[model samples]
Target: MVYIAEENRYSDMPYRRCGNSGLKLPAISLGLWQNFGANKPLQDSRDMLLRAFDLGITHFDLANNYGPPAGSAEETFGSVYRSDLSPYRDELLISTKAGYYMFPGPYGEWGSRKYLLSSLDRSLNRMGLDYVDIFYHHRPDPDTPLEETMGALDQAVRSGKALYAGLSNYGPEDTLRAYDILKSLGTPMVIHQPSYSMINRWIENGLHDVLREQGVGSIAFCPLGRGQLTGKYIDKIEAESKSGNSSMKPEAIEPARIAAFRKLEDIAKRRGQSLAQLALAWTLREGGVTSALIGASRVSQIEENVKCLEQGPLSEEELREIDSVSAVIKDIPW
Candidate 1:
């Protein structure tokens, strides 16, 4: 059967502005970082993508190194886009990044102009896209000069390879520098992608403050702490979970952490939500975050996550208990 999106898709999901840019992403965005890759089941990938759209998730995030074989996820997305999502091109916020290791040799990785631009071309080719809505430098390359990398991103927007430019995994100072460079070039930086969850509060220290001050929107990945904050690990890991698949090592969820997870689960139940819902709702409570990026191998997971928005934001007392539980959990060392 051909895929026709839900007519009321736009009604249920809330959209927020990405920084000061005109682009607005859904409050819940889908990410293809794990099981949606080529090595994974293609049918599952297609189902999840279609389901995400039905639930009003317009933003789909990707990276050059996302798939197990590297670049496979884009290829999968390309196939699905050609077959189903072509009609809704203008309505989607498709984004891909070019940092991290992609191919072999010197030019395959980093923030250099050569690597960033060329990787983007490959990403576009693989996705069968004329232009991506957003192109991001996957990570900060310490060896490369900030000017060179930011220049490449600006050039991408100017040349129309990407409608907007973004930065990922960049610290507050580096983000400010990149933003200034993009602003000088007449293409201001729009968004930042960082790893954030109740279990990992790295952004609370300074990243959030910087993003708000600089007016850059934030999309937080690992919103469930790589499945730690979800019900998947509340008891024992399912045989098919990410932890079972090596994306998250078994040792990452220790016995004590599981205990903490159950305690949090009770709080989520009290709030009329699942553990995953509680985690996502808490992540969005941060003022700087524009969206919380969620990755799933199954359509059911996406459906369950989408239902979180219906329950509304966490209450003040609930927020305090969540913080206490998160604090009691040990730092994930795996």
Candidate 2:
């Protein structure tokens, strides 16, 4: 069946500026970090992407090493793009990242001019696009010179291969350095992607303050704490849960995580909203966050998550109770 995008897709979700850049992204963006890989059925992944668009999610995040086989997710997205989404390209904010291990050898992964430039070319080929709206360095590369990395990203924008450049998983000091480097090169940093949820508060140490001061937009990933913040794993793991099976590694389901889930579940009960909704809304409550980058294994999950937008921000009392409970369990060793 040919997929037709929803006519009123742009009406429901509000868009926000990406830092001081001209681009505006939807409040909620879809991430293809999991389930969109080759291990999953193609039709199921396609449905999720289509459903996200119907709900007004304009941004789709991807990385070079996202697939189980490394690069298969972009291949799958390429197929989807050729078949269904080609006509709506103007309505989408497609992004891809490099810096993880995609190929083997010295320049396979990192922030070198050689690695970044070659990776962007391969990514554009895999996605069958002339250019991506945003290109990101998947992580900070301590081994590579920051100048070389910033130079490569600046070149990507200048050469018309990427419209904007961003950094992920970079701390305050490194981000400031990169921002200055890019700014000096006449291509200022636009966005930063970081892992943030009620359980993972590493960014709170100083990154959020830095982003606000520097005028960089932040998009938080894993806002549900890899499904733990959703309260789905409170009493016992469901037999059919994606991350709950016995085959799943123990490290993925730590004892402290279960304890945190129990505490979050209690807070949700008092608030009259699901733990998932609370987690999503709480991230947005912080001022610097431009959007929440979320992954949904099914169309139903996407439907449930979009409901958080309607529920809006938590009250001051609710925020206080959440913070108190969250602080006790925040140090859960992940």
Candidate 3:
């Protein structure tokens, strides 16, 4: 059957500009970090992509090392693109990153121009794309000169392999420095992807201030704290079921954290939201990131998560209660 996207897809969802650039992304974006890998069923991944598009999620984020064996997630995304999404390509915001360990040897990983550019070409080939909407440095490289790394990003944009450049997991100092370097190269940095959630409030300390000063938009990943903020482990930590979630180690799931999550659940109930929705809402509240990047195992999870947009902003009282709970279990490394 031919896949015709929902005509009214743009009716309900809101879009925010990426930093000062004209690129506007959906308030909620889909991330292919986990379930889109080769280990998952192709049909299942296709269903989630189609469902998310139907719900007005325009952005799909990926990275070189996302899949179990590395680079397989882009292959999975490419398969779906060639089949169902090719016709609607103009409406999609596709992004992919490189950094971290990809292949062996010196040029395999990190921020070197050789690795970043080569990895990007491989990524484009895997995704079957001429150019990505945004290409990001997955992480900073301490050994590589900042100019060389940022120059690689500028080169990617100049070579027309990526429309805009972005940074992920960079600190405030590095972000500003990279922004300046990209600016000097005539490619202004547009967005930053960071791990932000009720549990991980590290961005609030200084990164937010830097981004605001530079007019760089932000997309927050792990807004659910890798399923902790979802209220699934409020009663008991199921080690077998949650082992895949990186933040759910036995040592991290202390009883005090469980109590804090239960308290958050209570707040969610009062606000007429599920624990997941409340957590996402909190991540997008005042002074929060421009977009919340979410991962899903099922189409229903995407359906439920987008409802966070329908809910009102967190009230002053709700914010205070959330703050008090967050103060206890701050920065759980999600």
Candidate 1: Cα lDDT at 174 = 86
Instruction: Give the worst 10-residue stretch by lDDT in candidate 1.
Output: 235-244
RMSD to the true structure for each prediction, in A, is: 3.4, 3.4, 3.1
Clashing pairs in 3: none
**Candidate 1, 236: how far from true, in Å?**
2.0
Tens digits of per-residue lDDT for model 3, 239-267: 53355664556556666766677788899
Candidate 2 vs candidate 3: which has greater TM-score?
A: 3
lDDT of 1: 0.88
lDDT of 2 by residue, 178-296 (tens): 99999999998999999998878889888888888888898999998777676555544433233445554464455654555666777766766778877888888857389999998
lDDT of each: 0.88, 0.85, 0.90
Clashing pairs in 1: none
Ten-residue region with minimum lDDT total, candidate 2: 235-244
- Clashing pairs in model 2, backbone N/Cα/C closer than 3 A: none
Candidate order by decreasing TM-score: 3, 1, 2
